[model samples]
Structures are given as C-alpha cells and as structure tokens.
Target: MHKQRLVIAGSGSTYTMGMMMSLIEEKENFPLKEVVFYDIDEQRQERNAKATEILFKERYPELESFSYTTNKEIAFKDADFVFVQIRTGGLPMREKDEQISLKHGVVGQETCGPGGMAYGLRSIKDMIELVNDIRTYAPHAWILNYTNPAAIVAVALKQEFPDDHRLLNICDMPIAIMISYAKMLNIDVWEIVPEYFGLNHFGWFTKIYDKSGNDHTERLKSRIIDEGFTPEDTEIANDVSWQKTFEQARQMLMDFPEYLPNTYLQYYLYPDQMVEKEDPERTRARQVIEGRQNRVHSLCDGIIEKGTAKDADLHVDIHGVFMVKAAASLAYNLNERFIVITENNGIISNLPEDAMVEVPALLTANGPKPFAIGEIPTFYKGLIEGQYAYEKLVTEAYFENSYQKLVQALTLNRTVISPDKAKAILEDMMEANASYWPELN
Candidate 1:
C-alpha cells in the first residue's frame, strides 16, 4: 500500500477542512504520507492551517506529516494528487459577477449565464498557471479539478493541455443527486448506477439502476414529478436556496417529462423566473458569505481559541468526500464509475467531437473511460449545441483575448440573448474584473 502525498491548491476554501475530515475518515483506505495546504492568502490559510493542525494532532497524531504553505513548489513537490478548487477573485469578485449581471436583467449565478462566462474568463488564466506549476513540480500528480464553471474550465483545459490525461475535471452535483436518489429509493448510494449525459450543469439522468439491474428511472421520475426532488437526508437539501433549486425539478419534469433534470437547469429553462426571483442586493454569494463562509471561519476561530477540535461540530461535506473518493479510486485502481466532464470524442454521437460533455465513466489508475451515450433528441441537441458554442467561444476569447468573441459568447447565453445586453454585461464584468481577467480588445 503506497501512502500518497496530497496537495490541496485552494486550502483556504470553506470546504478544505471538510476535505481534511474526509481524509481522516478514509485514512485506512487512502493512506496519506503527507498533506500540504496551498493558498495565496496568508491570513485565511493560517486560520485553516491552525484548525487542521489541531484536528490532525487530536485525531491522528501519528500521521506522517501535515502542513500549509503559500509556496507553489513546496505544495506540489512530490505530490501524488492535487485537489484543485480555486476561486480566482474569491467571494468579492463573485458578488460583483452576480450584481453586474442582475443590473442588466439577466440571471447572475456563479456557474451559469453571464456570471459564469465572466467567471470562466478569470478562471482560465489561473487554472492554466496552476496546471503548469503542477506539471513542473509533480509531473505524475493526478489533478482532480473541482473548480466552478467546470464545463468551461474543462473545455479550456482540453485545449491547453490536450495530452495531459492526468487532469480530470469533475463536479459533485451528480454525486449529490445520486445521494438524493439513494435516500428516496431507501438504498445506499453505492448500490445504484446512473446513466447520464450533457454538459456540466446542463445534464440529465437518463437511467438509474440498482446492482440487481432493476431500473429505477421511472419510479424516481414519478416521485420527482409528484413531490419534487426531496432528498430526506442530505447536506444540499438543508439550504433554502438549494431546496428551491431541487424543487424546481418538478416543473422541469412537467415541461420535458422525458428525463430527470439537473437543478442548475432552472437557470437556463426558467431564466426569466430566476431573474425575477433573485434579489440584486442579496445574491447567492451574499448568502454564502453570510452562511457557509462565516460559519467555517467561526469554526476555525473556535478551534484556534480552544486549541482543540475534539468537540467542534464540523460538517462532513459529501462534496469533499466525493472528490477524495475519486482520488482513492484512481490510486487504488478501484475502477469505480463516476460522472465527470470530458471531451465528447464520439461519446455523444450527436454533439460535436470537440465539445466537453459530462457522462458516466469508469475511473481507474489510468484515467476516466467515458461510456457512450448515443445521439440525443433534437430538443436536447439544440440546447447543448448552443451552450457548447458559448463555452468554446469563451475559451477562445480567453486565449485569443478577443473582446468580440466574449460578446459572442455572452450573446449565446440563455440568460442574455440580445447583443446590446451582452455587450453591456460584458463591459460591466470587464470593469469589475479588471484586475483578474486579461485585457480583452
């Protein structure tokens, strides 16, 4: 059993401690020889480092090593796996992304519409830099990127690092959905297998079957149509915003009625409704800043004040666990099936070969081997094509620094259809993200 060296690139993120907790729980399966936390912010990372140190000492004092650093070389050096979850401009810029879009009367979400495009533009440069650093220091390290705007990020990475099979773009939303389905079916999540396809946030569950080959798609759809996506015991269901997003699946089912929709589709399928529902002053970023951000910081402060995390109630985030599990699968050659974002390459017969699509894949020590999802219906094909065009153009814009391409990308978004609105939103985003995004002319 080879003990691995794990590096968390965005160690200051609110989710880092939860990932550490997950590593603690799965120590026996995925032994860690060393764990390094890397973040650019000194103050914030130190708080996380303090809490993690306390937890590691109290929980697993004999663990080989645990440390945090701002040095990219120190963090990535000799690392076996790099967990990348970076936010380029953090919450402040995210809030700007949302508010700017809302001012223009479009849906302003972190990972959808104009807001997502803005985020994508800022993220590409950072993501590329991280990848380059990882390759330089730890060429063999597996990079499991859980970054937002995953669809766009994946597309850009594919273009940038076409030959790097070690890089895997993943999102926990599908796993979160499966957890809900498991709760509804009264079975452990591991007992079920799902067949799904689409770009990141805009995918659907075509089939779900148990180990015994019992198809549960219709049964799940029936429940979703009647009562909405009510997962009895899950972290995502606890939040009011998330609850609304989940429940909106019922309406999507009413309209599409062919497959179970991802919660994020609410942004695209009901862009007008989403805009109407949003409060410009108090966007989702504000809620997270007030809720998860504050809570995590407070918990860290408490751990630091008490000098122990023995009694501190920390959330065991399933999202973090999912990423850790994927890493473990790769390390141990478990060949577990997971939904990840990868290039189509004929995986979806109807979509362009170059487009990145999310589909179920078998994870092994090698990399993801995506399962084939044959040609989709006309309606889904059209929707995906439009979104893929926007994603491709955004990636191109970032690399080419073409303001025209950026405008074209925003214009294709479901949330901002008009060229004038797209231009206004792009210019506002450019001004707000001046420090982060590259000069586009």
Candidate 2:
C-alpha cells in the first residue's frame, strides 16, 4: 500500500475545510504520505491553512508532512493526486455573474444560462494553466476536478488534453440526489445502482436499481411527486433556495414523468420560475458567502484563536467525500461506479462523438470506462444537443476570444433564446468579468 501525496488546488475555498476533514475520516482507505494546500489567494488560504494545521495536528498526526503554499512548483511536485476546485474570480464575481444575468431576466445560476458562460470563460484560463503546470511538475499525477460550470471546463480540457485520461472530471450533485433517493426508499445510498446520462448539471437519471436488482425509479418518482424532495443532508436540506430546487424537481417529474430530472434542470426548463424565486439583491453567491463561507471561516477563526482543533465543528459533506472516493477508486482500482463527465465518444450514440457527456462509469486504475447508453429518445436527444452546442460554443468562445461565439452560445441556451437578450447579458457579463476574462473582441 503506497501512501499518496495529495495536493488540493483551491485551498482558499470554504469546501477545503470539509475536504480536509473528509481526508482525515477516510485516511484508512486512501492513506496519504503528505497533504498540501495550494491556492493563489494567500490571505484567504492562510485562514483555512491555519485551521487545517490545527485539525491535522490533533486528528491526523500520522506518516509525514502537511503544508500549504502559493508556489505551484512546491505544491504540484511529487504529488500523486491533485483535487482541483479553484473558483477563478471567487464569490464576488459569482455574485456578479448571478446579478448580471438576473438584470436581463434570465436564470441567475452559478453554472447555467449566461451566468455559467461567464464563469466558464474565467474557469478555462485557470484550469488549462493548472493542467499545464501539472504536466510540467507532477507529470504522472491524477487531476480530479470539482470545478463549477464543469460541462464547459470539461470540454475545454478535452480540447487541450484529449489524451490525458488522468484528468478526471466529476460532479457531486448526482451523488447528492441519489442520497435523497435512498432517503426516500429508506435504504443506504450504496445499495442504489443508478444509470444516469446527459451533460454536467444538465442530466437525468434513466434508471435506479437497488442491490436486489429491482427497479425503483418509478417508485421514487411517485414518492417525490407525492411528498416532494429535499437533499438528505442537513445543511443543504435547510437551505431555502435548495428547498425550492427540490420542489421544482418534483414539479419537473410531474410534468415529465418518464425519467427523474436533475434538480439543476429547473433553471433551463423553467427559467422564469427560477428567476422569480431569486432575490436579485442577494444571489446564491451571497447566500454561500453568508452561510457556508462565513461558517467555515468563523470555525477557522475559532480554531486559530484557541490554537486547538478539539472543539472544531467542521462538518464533512458528500461533496468532499465523493471527491476522495473518486480518487480512491482510481488509486486502489476499486472499480466503483460513479456518474462522471467524460467524452461522449458514442456513449450517447446520437450525440456528437467529441461532446463531453455525463454518464455512469466504472472508475479503475486505467480511468473511467463509461457504459454505453445506446441511442436516447427524440425529446432527450433534442435537449442534449442544444445544451451541448451551448457548452461547446462557450469553450470555443474562450479559446478564440470571440464575443460573437459567446453571443451565439447564449442565444442557443434555453434560458436565453433571444439573440438580443443573449447580447445584453453577455455585454453585462463581459464588463463585470473584464478583470478575469480574456478581452473578447
């Protein structure tokens, strides 16, 4: 059992604390020789780094070194797995992303519509740069990305590093949704075997079979429609916005009962409803800042002030655990099944071969071997093609720095079907993201 050296790329995030906590909890399964925190924002990372140091000292005083750094060479060098979760412009820009989209009567989400396109443009620059550095330094290291607007970032990375199977793109939403499904069925999450397909955040669960090999999809759908749905987690379950999201999931299932749709589909399927529920004065970014961000930072402040993590109240959530599980599946060849983002390559037979699609795959040492989802129906194919085009256009717009391409992408997006509205949102987003995005001419 060779212990791995892990590097968390975006250590400044509120999620880092949970990830560190998760690492400590899962140490026996995915043992580490070292753990390093790497982030560009020194001030933000310092708080998390200091708190993590305290937690590690008391909880994980194990094999070897633990450190945090801003230097890529120091962080990436000799690492076995790099968990990438960088937020390019951070929450302030995310607030702008939401507010800007809302100003134009579109879905104001972090990773959908015009807002996602803005965030996608910013993420490509940083993710590509990070991948290039990983190649230069830890050439053999596996890159597990948990970045938002994953559909766009995945496409961009595939275009640049087509053969880099070590770079795995994953999302936690499907896992979280499954948790809710298990709760509905009164069973453990692992007992449910899910068959899912689509792009990241924009997908659906085609089938869910229990350990007994019994199809529970229709049963779960009836439960959701009858009783509504909520995330099984305490923190997310209590969120007002998330509550509405689940409610919308129920509504979606009632309207289109063939398959259970991902909660995020609400934004595209009913943009007006999503927009109506939002408070333009305080978007999801602001909610995160006030909620999780403040909670984690405050915990850090407490840990630092006491100089001990004995009383630290950091809660490990599925987001962090899922990332570690993905890495472990690769490290130990567990062949664990997960819904991950991978090149379509005919996984969805009707979709473009090059389009990056989300589907269940067995994560092994070689990489994720995606299951074949032979052709889909006309309704799903039409929706997926349109969304895929939007995602591809966003990636192309970033690489070419073409404002026209971005406009085309937004126009194609379901949330903003009007070319004029797309132009309006793009112009606002361009000005808001001027500091982060490449100059689009």
Candidate of highest lDDT: 2
Candidate 1 wrongly placed segments (more than 4 Å): 231-234
Give lDDT tens digits, candidate 1, residues 341-416: 9889999998999999999999999899889999999999999999999999999998998999988988898889
lDDT of each residue in 1-441, candidate 2, tens digit only: 879999999999988888888898889989999999999999999999999888998999994888999999999998899999999999998999999989899899899998899899999999999999988999999999999889999999999999898999999999889989999999988788999999999889999999799999888888888888987865598888888788889999999998899999999999888889888898999999999889888999999999998867777788888899889999999999989999988899988999889999999999999999999999999999999999999998888889999889998999999999988887788888888898998
Error of 2 at 186 (Å): 1.4
Q: How does candidate 1 score on lDDT?
A: 0.90
